[model samples]
Target chain A: MSHASGPPPEDRIREDHRRAVEGAPDGGRDTTPAVGRRGGPALWRRAVEGSPVALARQAFKDARWSYLYKDDTSYRVRNGADANERIQAAARRMRGSTEIPEGVDANGPFINAPVWTWEVPAYFFLGGVATGSSFVALAADLAGDERSAAIARKVTIAAIGPGAPLLVLDLGRPARFLNMMRIFKPRSAMNAGAWCLMAFSTAGGAAVAADVLGRRRVAKVLGAQTALLGTYLGSYTGVLLASTAVPIWARSRLFLPPIFVCTAVATGAATNRLVLAATGMPSGHPTRDALGTIETVAMGAELALSSFNEKRLGQLADVLEHGRAGRLFEFARWAVRAGLMLRFTRGRFAWEHHVASGLYLAGGLAFRFAWIEAGKASAGDDEAVARMARGKATVKDRLRDGRTTARVRTSARHPGRDARAARVYADAVRRLSLAIEGVLRRG
Target chain B: MTEIAIDRPESRRMGFFTDTTVCIGCKACEVACKQWNDLPADGAVFRKTSSYDHTGSLSASTWRHVRFVEQTEPVPLPDLPAYGGGNGGHGEVDLVAAAEAHGVPQMDRWLFMSDVCKHCTNAGCLDACPTGALIRTEFETVIVQPDVCNGCGYCVPSCPFGVINRDPYDGRAAKCTLCYDRLEDGLEPACAKSCPTDSILFGPYDELVETAKGRVLALHERGVTDAYLYGAGDEPGEQLAGELGAFFLLTAPPERFGLPAQAESPAQENGPVATAAGLAAAALGLAAAVGAFARAHRR
Candidate 1:
């Protein structure tokens, strides 16, 4: 064998023959010996001999083959079948029922897990805050509240400082993030959002710089421009999510954007309220009260809209009420509730207002995290995806009055065992809404 | 059986017509695809639950995957030893023979489907791509330019079928190109060529659809009434935006093969609705802010 320690006797003899040929007068012309001098067979002959078919043929020729191992597996041999006879038999058996086979898990085949992690939600939160702050700045400037406007402009700049970096960090190729600007695609929400973010950041920076430089006219114009772009920035993250095949996000198409915007406005106003209060703004100052009122309304709307959409999501809504997303959402709900409570019960103490603002901001940020986490979970849910594909998950389906399709049959492998949990969930939402109503009435 | 001719002046829209019924759970196509594409193996994962499907689903490295859905009824544990004794040396129960001999009910079955990228008419990944990395070839198949993809991962969630994915090693999104290189040389895709039963057919798009329809009809005539074409039609105002370049003739529902029956490109409907809603909310917030500030100023 070629794998042996030394050349075989035949190769050794051929080498001696080649040396003899070289020593002889006419042997130099004889190339045959030179061809045989190699340790193994010729390349072509070796290739042919080494081929699997050749080896198998040789094996069969040597009487090594039997019915037990006649190029078929032991399973096939035992079944006494040939050419997919077993599979054909199975296929024939399956024709009796349309129901999917028991214990056959379909979820294993779906690979639509969300790639976006914490950085994406973090970026979304930051962008929303920046946009919100910019809007506040614009509103304050327009209302002739220069001091509030100045503070909001500073907040806008600070909030947007890490927006692009965080977004780039989230990319699979961080260095290639600039490629996002290579094309102008308005149809793609991510593309539009990227451009809006860049533009908003630029306008915000310029507005802040102009304000510092005493360029009042330039600052106002730029502030207005910043706010305009901020509007897109505040809600485009939701659009980005909605424009994906992720079931929960796509189904909440009409609501996600508005919900995001409400949070942005709430968080922005909350930040302003906290900043003003921290600067020793007297209790019930006109600007502080306005900011608080704006924060309260926006936070309230965000809570209501999210609850409505969560209900609309049907069975798919389990993503939001369970898992990591569920925990985060639970925290956000309490934070918003506490914030609203504090806002309603305004005391003489400035710390009370600061706590309320802090709670609103925390709630808004947590909502973003919860939504993103839920989206990740939603993408992996095969039944939810199937439901989405069947036009049963979206409001568009209801508008078309789609035929009431049967719910996906649950199995031991799949998730859908939450009837009692769902009841508790509904009760909680009902009680929460009632509490919100009572708070509003008392206020 | 349309022969793939080598000498053609121009490329016609060609695609795969995967008939799942005739598939025999053999993973020859998957092997051929991996060998031809020089794709990295998804390192040893012994999946005890998913019968013979260790690779799981189609992903960046795995362009073609054979999905094994075992529908066989649970055989009694006591019958197992008896079948082994009857079968002699190998000591394995002959499940098919047992079912055929009425030892087990004939309702037991196994379904095999080889899944690949759908290559939708209005591909969500292509539309949602911000870098213009994804493009439609002359054959009407969507391809991602590796050099252009910045790995923004927008296309990852954009795919309705979850075929495209970013490679963990490089972070660049990768998927089946329908063997673009092979097609350019007038060769059939590796997966189609390797399919032993002609389960994965390759030909002109229109011809393939007709052939698939005929195959379904033929199956129906053969008493396989469940056989139907998925991603074959352009239903007006339906969720499926348009026809799939690579479609399937399935015996079970699309979801059984991890395919969405009524997938839509989010760009067409969802994108617009979201943007409109966002704009409206922004306007509302802006107005609210202005009004609130005005009231504060008066105070």
Candidate 2:
């Protein structure tokens, strides 16, 4: 094994490498022996080998023994044995239908799914719609579109009417709702969300209450304030999801909130359109046309943003694209697309508009519910989480090892660096440390 | 208002650096935790699971958990020393014949890990708590003030590791306190104290990191190249050592232990979302302003 290797010759070095090449014009000769030559990226590449994902994937492929049937574990099996054999064997040994099989444990550990159940998602949906509607109400009121304003305000009030109760219900007790107000930590998304929810409901309810009382000026003032609170209300739920360790949520932290905010606007506009159609608002009316346009554009923005976010999320994107989340996500996407297509085909007066508006409303709620489902799936899949942390595979590694972690630093053996230079560097470091200590003492 | 300072402490952070390689799958730490904390029973029945573990996970009731992860891979032909061996310790086993005779196609690599709250520097529970309930103690450990918790369940989904949980009966969020009370008495946490194999080591957070790294290096020298320390480096988002008060020297990927791959605490989410909301609100406000301007000029 001839180990004589040193820095590359001048001819072998590219312009970038030329600067570091010992014999190049810009560099000095190291004169190190061949065995101790410091060289290129091969050393660095070897250092970064075997990331957790690659290790796990290797183990998975190497698995030759799998239980005969579907369960969480791999059992030793002959080449052609049925995969469910383990489950079958366990079942046979069990007493009856009432007895559960030990092989059921093969599905692996019971990942504690997100404890936030139906009430939480329902609250997210209601709050998003309410926030969306508040903006519509404020804009319409400001533009002096009294008819549209009145309808929008009614939708906002109606959505929020049950929102407070849903939030309390999700907390399990009435006291928990009050506990949310015990402290204000502005930096905390949860704290900010709670405060914003409270403000939005109070201001939105007040605006509608003023409208009911025939106080137009007071209603308009409170409506604007409600929109102000709605800004955070519409977007914070997405932030809440993104803040967790959930792979799907954490992977696209920057864009999830934007996607949520845009969707909120779409849902709000759709709610107004539905309310207007129910109240007999004319399709030819400019206010109705404007709301449809807003809904279409907002849905478009939401779609574009989330697609980009998903792409950036890499492996974690599967969290949103698989299982129950996948079905719901597909339906929501189709609903948004259909809703937009309906606007181009017909005016708001057409029956298609009413259906499309309902689709838009349903799509928004579906998206929230789907997002939570996706989070649960991501939590369950250990491999997906590992891949996400290691990041998307590069072209070369993706096919092979898939184990390239961030740093690949390798210790290059430098031949006896004329001892004088090393001695000087060591002396300097020692002196520097002592100097810093003296400075600290003097201060 | 609950005060939330998301910064890591300047003082020495006391923590546990669990070396999973040395673990012997003992439940002593779990028992010690329950005894010291006076926690209610999570039951001793053999729950059907993918592995030998009966305690499924960390919860409000059960603070310490041991995971039994079984990988379906053949061991190397020339077996190296098992973890925590190699020093006058011989653990060589010729299982090739045993594996094939059993009708098993390949070898089995069963790994066990003792799981606990990471006591993350950017803890989601501490950041999300609205009632001043979850707070970082002076030791840089996170502890939930049970009496202060209102059980809003915000802290439940907020935790990246799902370590903090709300009990159904108690209706309050709770989790491992890292034995803050014991630490105050100059005693190590119960779990670490009871760990027979020294798998779980408690010390200054930085010191434990060095020790863990050295152990991983030693394992590598013995030809166990797969041995690695998780949560010890600057792997961002919910990682230990780099961002957690409690880190681990894991023999496998963290997710295999049910830990999140990318964990961003609640506090980390605020900046980006707030920016998006700000920009969106500004745009909407501008649109509303233009509409108001148009209405005023229409006359």
Candidate 3:
């Protein structure tokens, strides 16, 4: 609207100077336009103004000034408007426009969230159970419980049935599943896990076959070999998860494998115990007592290791405490607790042992799902990923920042007890994060 | 005697040295990379918060990404005068007058960086790929062999820089190859060739490192004291197995650009983790078996 008329003010001013330099009789004053540099005649000269159209326009614009400019935050432009002021106003608007909200990662969601779905966790559960069953079969044979050993061997084969297929089904290209066996890269946990799974399945299957054929010596030899590979099969998934950049899984490296192995044994023993009970094995049977003891110890260890790892994860543990994963973890904890309680206070009923076994199996499966889901959540957490990548520096920086903020808030609230209160608060924080402190100091 | 055969000289290790100080944020490198690689479009979703960086981060389809970080905090521009227009109205932006009136409007700096794969010497993806799909080229650039990749998705999580990704449509992992095909034909990478500011310099690894060091020194001489080389490091954690094939000269902290401060191959931690896992499994598995059998004997 300002540029809706003739030549710009600068051009007009230059033209006026050119005319004055030509030695015109009346200089450039008479030829000057009524609409000048400021865009209108002075208010005092309004009555003598030559252009009535320009004067009328000015009066109308002034009358509607408040209405037009009321909502505009840059209303100070009414005093003076220039390119610099306009640019500054734009910069101001841009600055206020879309600030990355507090706690939102400015640079990233970081690593690609794990692409695994239900199939992977399901496979983990089945694989763990199979490995655990193999161990049970070997142990039972050594204990001279041939009946229970045969049942354990059958269980191992049963679990391995769907485990291999579930793992293949989770691949992006399922048809290319055989590619995993094309290389023997022990450096890769996944490759090592694949080989272990194959070895365990082959040996376990042969053992089950031999047992059915009444070849006890051949079955025992194969069962021992299967159990040897089962150690990796049950625990290498932990290594697989830990060897990645996912914060929670990688941070819980030392605990995840042991936790996984414990769950495998617990679930395996539970399955074998339930089968034996269903076959009318008496409650006083030595095999039943052994299975019960093994299951109980394994469950206890799983719970203890999980708690320790969760404490070490710090704020990264939030993924395991909120959302779907959190609910699954909660259920798993309760299921294990219920199973342990039933084991401790079992009645004469065989159904009580069956129920306890069922709880342990369900709990182990739920634990696998919870860990997988927690890993996905942890991978998507930009702060946790950044903390992992930045390593101990970010942890220390955040801890220091947290302490300062706490001190400031406390000082503002209680000036007299600032030092003492701050010290107490800092000490509590230090204790809470002490699990990671050793690693940080070592690094 | 058998006829003596002529031998070819050993291939020189090549790399990219990205000097982000002079980058103009033109995004020519992004276009050139996609155009040359024949990669698919990364969908059309206008990201309102990520500034002009619409092609977000480096992914399977988009190999080179120009990161735009709009730092709006008020920073001191020491070289420029706060007040302006004293001498014949030449000064356009009267920052002092504007600041005095508007209480210092936030317009500090607009940092632009062209990010690509770090192509680490000890790449986590290469180490973790179970299918033997990811391999290091003669130029020392890590590339995923698309034909061989089974899309097991192991490499996706193993990359510490988050540069490699499994394409949802293709169902295979993909990332920058450092223009291996172009290198074979004695041509520079498309991204480096198309860079308007010569920000992305492609050359022999040793020569590029020297050039990068010289540029960093020049920047420091010109008062850009904060300028430092990332990935071209002597420190252990700063480099992944000695150095990255594609390193950067950055003014801001590495995290500000989504690069890790302590860059390392996640696979490097495999030894201790595997050892502990194996020990734990052995101890727990053996103990449970032994305890179960011993208890049966006692009974």
Candidate 4:
């Protein structure tokens, strides 16, 4: 009713701002004594009011004052009202303007959150590379690329140097590392990871021993076994993480194994490139080019799969995309891109190969390190965990009519059906995730 | 892995159903747990800050902890008119008159809940333990074989609840054994035995669950709408740590009592790991085949 002949919306906003500024000195000051500030207008005006706009801005900063203003102004703005009253009236027009009460995370919820440190991620990274190196060695040996095979074998065996100590170091005692294989239970991923690492290391060690002893048949046989164990070693760590209740790790359960395996191959091939390049394997050689191409594809797949999982994770993506872990994840992406560019450049410098492989290795390590840290961040946040838990629907369910229950409990009585449902639940989630990712990419 | 930690057919399952509503917050259970377990006093560092909490959390030393959470709201309990029984005429009359004159405003409510090890059904720490240091007892409770533990700290992160901690002096993972020694002798845990108000009740698992359900129903009838059982079926507790040996009757959100509202047990929680492994293998195989094809084409 008051705005019957007022200016346009934009101009009205401007006029309101001007009026607010003009009324600030006296109108805001005069109302202050009623609110209980000492020595009233003089002190408060000196501290708060240069203009009504300044006072309003200060009030916005103060949650309590904003609440009072919002509470007072929310209905009708009087055209000739006092500036403070007009400001309140203007604020009343805004939607969802609720006061934020003062509170605390009194329980120190995030403290003692995640105990995983350098040793665990380092073990995962080195062990994965070793596993992939063994696979590369096996592939080379089968392809009759003896020169590539021999170097691959040496790299595979040698990669265990840091890997062995890392596992032992995390265990805190050498005997404890041995004690991990007290009994093998296929159901437990940690147990399986432990035993897989042990066996792979043992076979890798034996193959290296045979190389020195000139036992050709023995070395080949053991190398094949190690490569087989490498399959589990390279990817089981992801399964191990997925098997845990950790929010970040568990949410990415479907994609983690594939991502880890891809990373393992990329890192392993990068290490192989460094070894071959250092040993004077010329650029554009068939074996070298093949390994580099394979590494590139694997890494690209890893990035795609990681993005897919992150998309499905919804709000939980903050941990992997926001904090210190987020920075490391960002660094890995750049490193991957830079490394890929260097690998393709025709006239790349001899040192360019070294630098590229170095970046690839750094990227691999960063992925593992950031993943562990992100798991910590994910666990600390209550909201993210809840959101992820709520995302029980797989991509299939999202698209289809028969949506699986929010949580599917498997009964022991119907093992076969329950197992099938569990498998379907998992597959539906991953397939749907990939589908959603495809849509997002196209969109 | 063993389904429920306390489902052993040979021995009856035992647990504690702590009713936080009636907890006195005296820290007696904390003292009793340490005393009976022969634990060292690490909570004595009187940090003058923080809430009125000394034994802030359950740790290797403090097996039980009473958390005092002070909330600034009008007190839940109404002002009583019968205090001092109106015995002293001048003082009592003056106090009553003063009470009528000034209304109680912003009365602080301290939510005191004693916490102990949850002894989760699908124990992540036990599943994650590589050295077999952690084991599910025949009594359906989980315990750490301290002699066998090599302090790998694997169990530390595995636990959804921050219950287990390493003894800094001994360098081994230690936590509430549910008084395994006493349980074997048919005795309740010291914390339950010592609770003055019977807030901490120990008995057969099923019976304790029934008692908790009844108490929650009673509280609801009495208009305590927020009162719900933690670790009770149909709650988020059942979703993760189903039928927890040590559960609670909380008057507010689990977070208010420093508890995770939705606890997840890794073993019970399944995802697409197996399918992902298969996909990974298939992708690698395809990549390898493409690499071979490219080499042959170049030839």
Candidate 5:
């Protein structure tokens, strides 16, 4: 395959081949090529004289060539001088006879390209808004404080306003957004998401409107709906990521949904606290106390779950614990710590400690962005795939070994009358042993 | 008089099986998704430099995403003794030495997977939406009700795949609906129908899972042993009751596919923790306030 590369150091090639074939069954008996001169198999005649390294290399090359030109079938018949020549010949055959093809270049035609476009940052932003708003709503509802509840409702509505538009704009055809409700397919995540968003928004808006209109009864009904809708809205993002084919995201799928919910709750709590402080809510107000508690607990769960996810998925840990994601994680940690400290602190600092709440909000949003970015990065890499392949191989090898050993033991116990039975059993054992050896040696 | 009943037929469910083994990494599914749904063409300005996958990740506009990965390893091609050479391949190709001589990069493998929204059995987005905008279809696919959405981004955070997003321009939550209109019309989804490689096979949920298991077994039988299914066969929690509507056959660990092998519901798991922490903080703050008030009164 080398282009005038001066026949690549013959000694190195020979040495490699020798090393590869060192423990062949034939054991250096017949010093000849595995294939006969007439391009035919010579398995029985040769005792593995050819270099194993060369053999392995040839096998891989043959596999690639065969796979590439399998459809043509006839390409193998017309042998070329080298692998590249064969590939070129196969490509030529596949393209069909052409004379000065117009608009065709050496690089081949751009047959199919991706038409879909995903705005990564937009996903992060929308998630943050949704979760942040949910936290505020939850804290407000729990505390039974009208002022806090109104602010929470407003925040939730505002967050959704920006979030919904971004989602629709992301679609190549924004006009068809309404088609999502034409029919409900329970299996489709988008369908469910549409309903969730509608319910949450309506309840939230109704609640807010009722509060503005001074209708306590209407507000109470809407508030209940808002809480229900908010719960699903805060948690579904996890299911969405888990449902995809990206390894990193899929592996930690279960963990993400709950984490997102917690993060949202934490963020919402921070926002609620900030709003309350700004509005000069009394220091010992139940609403303030509830928001502080939610913030501290939510932050703790978020950090703990994230840590658990990282520990459970080893090499995959690189996504969150290393790179830019690690920085985000650190920031989130600091925010949580500060929020907790502020929430627990007493006296003068308690009344003036909205700084920690602000930090939590910022940190929560940053964490959401970090996760989205990390998932994107994780999906873009190949090392994770290779590692999975290796893991599968190990499992398969173990199963095969166990099966072989069981068969050998069963045969031994049977004690068949004929010597052939014994010989067959012995051969099976030998093959199994060799296979085990191979695996060990390779490892 | 009316009869009360439970376990409706509509609740039984349907799903998708995405076989990544044969995926050619062609984003035909992604294109078909946008076209069939009449979604706006997600603008073409973005570029994901890491791989050929320019779509980046799933979003409202791009409901389907194709991921590309490249892996490298030192592997020697088999020598062709059948040709007219000596011990090495015909004419002594010396692939390794030749590779070194030509300064070729080390051997590498490429893997490509097309990602889409996972309509979980227990969808967090569906659980978290306070506006009732997101709902489960009769077919069990999760969808967003655009008209009622009111742009509450709650569903965005609730999704695990990060698949759903609000269109920056239109203010509505959006993501894949598995072509619900087509399904109603007795047709396969556009993405599954358009997949040339049969990589994204569409069928009854049960059959797909069976087929996936068979394929994984076949791959194991062959030398390509690193094959497994994700989001199938296990119901972890009440929040996640059934298997996924969309599942995948991956060559790597679940994480590599951006999925959690052991799925958990973030909302359910963290809700209590967050609530507890909030209560604790509130108690402490209240105690401090009461103590300060007493001190002032005593003075």
Candidate 6:
């Protein structure tokens, strides 16, 4: 019926006119001809109106819209429920394939997980052991007490056993840990440290072993030698972190090493006190009191140094303020406070003081853990790295601009445009090439 | 034996002018140092993914470190590409265009600076060290004595720039000696010698200062208003005021390059606080111990 006699030409024209006007730009001219000129609405249809590609493209667009807006997935399975529920679920499903969950092996490959060097923790442990042993020795020497010396020897031996293992374990190849002693390279702190530990450990172990074997006279002689070597062993851990190129570590070098030394002493004192208490040694013993005093001093120094360094680091202070480092620092602070409280109240609360000493020991270990963690945190972040890169680029850009300006200034004095231009261009090209090459190579 | 005058100021002081402006972040200085010193390649294997720096921070093996920094700016110039392309690459020529085309609000810029031991005038590391491990050489450069270091690592935190580090393997503090061996032979440091752009300039302390001043003036004249010399003036202390052994002509704030703008002495900062705390703790402990002894005697 429509083919023979559709609506009146005027009626069809009005309907078509409304559709065209709806699609036109509000402020633009209407360029479509009257529907009457084409005879009817059917006359306005194009030859490619039913093209499959066009329909597919529209279908793709609809599917993309659903996929982007809705989280519906393509996979479907029976839920042992109603069919109506299934249909509803299917309707909700987005047209595109679902993204595989992360960590699912069947999904796809992912970036290799990052493995941080364990050397940081090893450094922390060794430094702690060495410093702690030194404090014991220092207290013993100051008090003219032989028992303290005995305790110091014991602490030093313990330090060597655990500290040495940690240091070796930190090596990429544990077997190669011994290779550090192959040569005496002065430029390498680790090489120097390996030798120091070897000598100190050997001497300390001899003193400790002799004492254990009931050779009091020999032990005394060996103890003195151990003390001499132990001081160096304890102190060097501080310098080890300082000698590096990491800005955060290097900038805080002066304080970091000292802090480590002080921390070690505190840890050693706490450990000895805990041992004395567990062994039922008399409370308020002069040696125990002296050890506590040494621990208190060392803890104070370590806390103060860490706090000062963090404050001075400014934006970089995030390493100590947040994440795992922040947690470590928090625990360390708690331990230090508990230790100080116990030491202060030692006369009033003897058993409580021992408990506090235990806390102090925990705190010291935590401090080392936190310090190492923070240092690693500092190295892992992108903000610091990006900041450093930008600083270098700024300097480089200025230098390049300066050189170019200098060349232009020099070339301006020349008479010939060709020669001056050639010189300037060549110089610019050379400089640019070098700059680019440098960036690429660095990357 | 003839004795040197203690009060008379030393005339010849060696120094380093790490231009930072021209540093390519190659870390050649670090590698060259280990090679020249015959140091072990310990931390070299730890490739840091956060930045181009793989060795993380300075350690026993790495004496000279080149730090890489990235910064962002609001204005985008079409001429500068994010990653610098090669000499003949189209990216090189169209860097400016690409930057402009992106029309992004923030654009990143890179910085590279090779850092080394400051070898300061006061040398806090030397002052704080108990074993006399850290010492000022005849060349006026601070060096850690490996034999004497005792692994105390006091010098590590004593340094304001954190340049000194102790080796984990040997337990000794180590750092750049300004290639003291090379200096002894009247040769420049391996870093300065190998630097293609002369970014790591090695010279007499006074001459470098003067040259740095002249360069700063030249930069200002060329409209590089941000250029300034750090650790060159006498603001922080009289000792550091005259010149820095390892100074820098920085384009931005020194902190951007991880160098504090004002010199911070770690020993000075912590000294009084630590001392006060130590004294207080000692007094409290002694008082408690004495009271405990008296009570025990009474019992």
Error of 4 at A201 (Å): 1.8
Judged by TM-score, which candidate is best? 1
lDDT of 2 by residue, A354-374 (tens): 888888888888898998888
**DockQ list for all candidates:** 0.24, 0.08, 0.13, 0.07, 0.03, 0.02
Ranking by DockQ: 1, 3, 2, 4, 5, 6
Where does candidate 5 stray beyond 4 Å? A1-144, A345-347, A388-443, B1-299
Chain B TM-score of all predictions, in order? 0.85, 0.81, 0.85, 0.82, 0.80, 0.77
List, residue by residue over A154-207, the lDDT tens digit for candidate 6: 877876767676665543223333334433433334456667777877887888
User: 5 or 6, which is superior by DockQ?
Assistant: 5
Itemize residue pairs with steric clashes in candidate 4: A73-A88, A74-A92, A395-A432, B6-B140
Give the poorly placed runs of model 6, Cα more than 4 Å off. Answer: A1-443, B1-11, B22-59, B70-109, B168-171, B236-243, B296-299
Per-residue lDDT for A318-420 in model 4, tens only? 8888888999999998898888788678534777766777888899999999898898887777554433333332342221121122332322121134345
Between prediction 1 and prediction 4, the one with superior lDDT is 1
Model 1 chain A is weakest, by summed lDDT over 10 consecutive residues, at A406-415
Question: Which candidate comes out best when scored by DockQ?
Answer: 1
- Model 5, A1-443: lDDT tens digits are 00112322223444556778889877644323333321111133235654242223321231122221133321122222453332223222222122212332121000111112244234544554554555455434444455666777777777676666666555433443454454443333445656777787777888889889998667766766676566666666655555443445545654776677677666766776777677888776766766666666677778888888777777766767677767887787787777667766664666446777777777777777677667656654444423322222122221112222211000002213455664455345434534543465478
Cα lDDT listed for each candidate:
0.72, 0.63, 0.70, 0.63, 0.54, 0.54
Fnat by candidate, in order = 0.43, 0.16, 0.30, 0.14, 0.00, 0.00
The most accurate candidate by lDDT is 1
The TM-score-based order of candidates, best leading, equals 1, 3, 4, 2, 6, 5
> Residue B181 in model 4: shift from native, Å?
1.0
